[model samples]
Target chain A: MGSAMGVLLDIAGVLYEGDRPIPGAVDAVRRLRGSGLAVRYLTNSTRRPKRRIVERLRSLGFPVDPAEILTPAEAACDWLRREGYAPHLLIHPDLEEDFMDLPKSDRIAVVVGDAGPCFSYERMNAAFRELERGAPFLALAINRVFKDRDGKLSLDAGAFVKALEYSSGTPALLLGKPSRDFFVAGARSMGCALGDVTMIGDDAESDVSGAIAAGVRAAIHVQTGKYRAGDETQHDHRPSALARDIAAAVDLLVETD
Target chain B: MGSAMGVLLDIAGVLYEGDRPIPGAVDAVRRLRGSGLAVRYLTNSTRRPKRRIVERLRSLGFPVDPAEILTPAEAACDWLRREGYAPHLLIHPDLEEDFMDLPKSDRIAVVVGDAGPCFSYERMNAAFRELERGAPFLALAINRVFKDRDGKLSLDAGAFVKALEYSSGTPALLLGKPSRDFFVAGARSMGCALGDVTMIGDDAESDVSGAIAAGVRAAIHVQTGKYRAGDETQHDHRPSALARDIAAAVDLLVETD
Candidate 1:
């Protein structure tokens, strides 16, 4: 790719699967960075902190830095800090460690995600009560399912987020993939305009359509990890290009350049 | 009402609000019974067993019998028993006592309701896994909201049921108030044909339209409990009559008779 072309990469299904890295993904990242392309990792994963995700990538032999990783937790934490809001987080227990740096106060804002074992009726109702009392609702992502460690598709955070929305009649502010702000913020972190960046990932809706909607220069769909057959055809948004995998996507980018 | 005119009454909004009975509701039931009308209490309440519900109504000074009280749980339990399906109950902890009489086996069927404090990601995912494995999804009721003890509208079982449906790509068989089968079952239990029965309730969609669709002779919408000001006008199925409350509903039925 050209030196000025920035790229946003998805993590869970693109570069790695659970603790294992996708084949040729680590080399593809190296090749993209070697080509002087500005690259940032954008993810909707709410189960782990950004530091943990970075550490995981490094352990999997991928060259990922803390600054180069973008997650909804970070975006939510930033939004919370910037707005001076005290959030009542209903996220995964492992993800709670990331929001400890925010200011603590009596003000309550309801934040929801795939809380895993941490999700309970008490906590959900607590969040619902806050929403009923006019507190703001923030969602990490509405992705329906995620591939678990056992290689099985498990329910994601979207169901619970939607449940709360349906119950309270309050729309949630999505701060993760498919949300234009999350995409634009990632591009901004790379010091590039939205129109100058390209997002490449397996999830057609979250990564591809989300980036395209945010006015990113282009979005590339990779037919690896979590890429369902005919996903590109089913969705309303069209991907700018399609590749066999992350490695092929990198090659396509470079060849097009 | 005439001796042959059977009345199907909705309990939650029409006769009671949480633990407390609506003013004059007990007297209305008594008057309807005194007039020699066949009365059946059709409810969508899944938080408690039918026995407990009947006891609660009795405690609240309503002349309700075990056979006179019909709930979605009872309908669902009956359906399960008839189909010889072993049920994995995802319902309120208190409601578990109701389905204990079902035959035990390795054959897994998912039965869902307002699980209340029992609703967790693990349990929900377990149910989703069962649905994915081709188990039938049975829902007690899909009523969007219910009036709570504090008189505020609270989230009901429908939201979770819908979440599971959306996630697993499975449709739930509703065995509750809005389902025509549930309404017909109540009429059948009363030894009355569907055309000889009248349903009276505050919820327009579940009680009124549901009965009308099931071929009930008439449906009455009451302006009490959770009834919004214009709910009767907003729905496509017009209630045969509109009353101010339970007392007025009984009066309207008798006067028309």
Candidate 2:
């Protein structure tokens, strides 16, 4: 497998939903690997650290390397380190272990994601006060909604991110899916040019349209996981291919190759 | 001194700053009363009950009748009763006493205000679930920012309200200040026609512009609580007169008479 043949895979709603892997999703990844295709798991799950996420995938019988997962939290850490910004993280406690190595300073930058229980008025106000005193605002993902533990749709970090944005009159710096830079970086990490990689995801906007915008060769949108009826017509940039599930999506990619 | 010539007053930033009354506001209201002007205090303070607000005003030496205070909570309760909605309230605990008269049922309508400590991810998510199940959404006030107990600017209910609206794709029906119906109702309760009332407040949008849209005779923008520089130029509906503070606003009304 070379850079010319690679796939960027979305984890949630693509591989495993919550703790359970979608049926045939593991087999689909295995088939892609057997075909000599490069695979990188791109996720916007801000509720847990990368180590935990990798652990969950392994327990679910999926073969995943910790290094191959490109979570927005990890990307945000890399971006913050490069810019020399000290983060005042407003994220779930489970996700804080990822940034324990960063240097602490009074010069704080408000780093936020789907904090779950941590999204309190005090925490948000503290973040707002920091922004009012001239601190930058950063977000892991601005996803509107996510599947909860019970599998019902719940308010995601995007709503709170927008709240802080409106309250402080400051725009958030996005570092997750649908961000062109993040998508291109994922392609580069796979040792592939943006035009060589095929993106696969359940979300039309974040995965398919985002990969297209980032210059991916093609994107396959799956019908499972958060896909509503008429999503294909709802966007100006339609997915290059559509599949019933991860199995069908992998089959389409193999046949096309 | 009758319904033919009435004045609508705003609380908080106009008559008082936190616990302390604004320097001549007490005397200004006293003068308005002495002149036999019909006065109604229109407030969007969802943090406290109307009884507490009336008590606070009395303690500050401003002669305020309980009937004169028009709180959004009271208006919301009235609307809920009339519309036959059993609300799932997301508000400060202190304000819950105001809705004690409402009958309870499983059919929920999300009633939100400045929820203060009651604003948690669990509660917000619960509200989101209710809305997803087709519950109607209502808001007492959606003011962007409010002065906290610590005298610092804090994120108000508007941020959360907008978040819920974005998450559910449902618009919240506002029942507080800046709502045209609330304004007109306050005028009617005073036995005054909307065209005979003159509204005065520090907030340019909610108080002045709202009054103008409600067909009030005139509106005076006061430079007091929550009023920022350039607020006069920010709105399309300019105030009929500008005043240094509540005292000056009262003076303007008296001079015109």
Lowest summed-lDDT stretch of 10 residues in model 2 chain A? A227-236
Off by over 4 Å in 2: A1-4, A104-106, A209-215, A228-238, B1-4, B104-106, B209-215, B233-238
* Candidate 2 structure quality by residue, lDDT tens digits, A31-126: 888888889998888999999989999999999899899988888888788888889889999999998888666567889999987799889889
Candidate 2, residue B63: Cα displacement in angstroms equals 1.9
lDDT (CA) for every model shown?
Answer: 0.84, 0.85
Error of 1 at B180 (Å): 2.9
Compared with the true structure, what per-residue lDDT tens digits does model 1 show for residues B35-125?
8788998988898888788888889998777988888888888888888898888998899888888887677889999988789888998
iRMSD values, candidates in order: 1.4, 0.9
Clashing pairs in 2: B1-B36
TM-score of each: 0.86, 0.92
Assess the local accuracy of residue A241 in candidate 2 as a C-alpha lDDT between 0 and 100. Answer: 86
Question: Candidate 1 residues A1-257, lDDT tens each?
Answer: 43337999998889988678889999899988888889999998998887888889899999877998888988888888888798898998888898888888777778888787787877877787788789999999988777777777778888888788877778999999999989889889988899899899888778887678779888899987777778887566889888888998899777534
